[model samples]
Target: MSDSNKTDFTNPSTFILVGIPGLEVAHVWISIPFCTMYTIVVLGNFIILFIVKTEPSLHMPMYYFLCMLAVTDLVLSTSTLPKMLSIYWFNSREINFSACLTQMHFIHCFSVMESGIFVAMAFDRYVAICHPLRHSTILTNHVVAKIGLALVLRGMMVILPFPFLASQWPYCRTNIIPHLYCEHMAVVNLACGDTRVSSYYGLFVVFCVRGLDVIFIAMSYTQILRAIFSLPTKDARLKALETCSSHLWAILSFYIPGLFSSLTHRFGHNVPLYFHVLIVSVYLLVPPMLNPIIYGVRTKQIQDRLLWLFTHKGI
Candidate 1:
């Protein structure tokens, strides 16, 4: 009987996602803000893509990277938000095992892709500011396309192991994931077998992808700052620095919350489960919603384009 029960428990077909462990009563109220944010993320990123595509003048490597970032944000948020809303609104928490793994793949894959896009954007800024003469020659349309392809492949390869490993894990324990979506670690934790390999590999992926991305971005910006300061006039330096303002805001908005959510999940023992869930959820959704607004408000080109779009074309 005991053996049969264990066999039945191993690798159950479905997992139950407990939205916000302690805040179930408030899920309805909480979803209002989340829904609003998701709406903004979708519409804002779509508008960014549309504007970038329609305006010939905006057809540059930098804008290309921006469009990639916008698309990544769209995928990253869309992977988790709809199901989250379902969990909150309709009490639909059951997820098939394979479907959960798919969600886990996309949530992490696009996240890594977003980090890569930031690195690409940073490199674009570096080339534009530091080597203005070679900017066009260096990052031509072909090179930009290759970069996008490489980033997509890189993200897909790095995250491919996550779902495979999770599926292989002998899940003899309960399948109740105490959070919104199928977070990779949360799913892995249910395994009755050894999890050290998966856990360490997860850390390895984070370091290799996100940690290295941060390092590359920092290096690019260091050179960018050095180049800006070397300009002959204050106005020249200001002009060069101003071009990076939107990108800087986008980086800070995305990385800060991401870092916090990661740290709290791994190290914040005393933190409430509900709080952790909320932070992670917000981290995923807020940046996508904020990126377009930052660019539209801060980038003079985007601002002008938006104005032209609304006033002249009624878009």
Candidate 2:
């Protein structure tokens, strides 16, 4: 074969992303909900940030962590949704290899950061409910700032290898990605060489970020529940448990779908590709949309501030 005719598998200039397999006809219709969800994610998260920033009374450890969660959700959703909507609405599916890597890094980085934020928030709740007297001293402003910085650095350091390992692979087989975005495994799976290192490292990252964080969160909530029950009055116990409901909902919304999607994508070979893609898309989008609402409705301080802001036209 001539040099020009020979396939250049070493590195393709671009990878074509299939928005959703076997759902070409519904792309337009599908874009509607996705666009709506993206809108909600943006507006909702921004609102949370705004409310937390302008209201001096809401300045505390819990709201600080809520702000972190909101920012994480914003980055997490923005990293994937715009391109996905572009693929669905405009049929623009070409993603540069470098850009793909960038998207992959942001998606995973913010995901891990979100997980870390959840753990921090759970610990905040634990301290607030379990040791109400020392809550302020325990989670001081300096401590909260340090926790935020640590979460950022931890996520970046852990996920830094993802794009590096992915980029090191030789994608000689094909430049077509069957999923919506440049998911780490999806991009790595396109490589022609052995992907054991990348696969194993990805799992390691999951364990470091998700597995350990989940354990910490569970432990924190366990101690929290014990503290709530030991309260002297029924009303005190009910009020304390009510405070955790929003956090519980946010945790469930994020981890349950995320875990389900991750498991099905890895082991459920019988599951349809489109089904997996849809699940992942929902997993990413739903949490951002629901988190702010959950916190706004369930947390009294945020609810009061939201009302005041709306009533006063954000004055």
- On lDDT, the candidate that comes out on top is 1
Model 2 per-residue lDDT tens digits across residues 12-72: 7788898899998999999999999889999989989998999999899999999999999
Query: Per-residue alpha-carbon lDDT of model 1 for 143-188, expressed as tens digits?
Result: 9999999999999999999999998988876778999999988899
Q: Candidate 2 — which pairs collide?
A: none
Error of 1 at 87 (Å): 0.7
* Model 2 TM-score (2 dp): 0.96
> CA lDDT, every prediction?
0.91, 0.90
Q: In model 2, where do residues sit more than 4 Å from their true spots?
A: 1-6
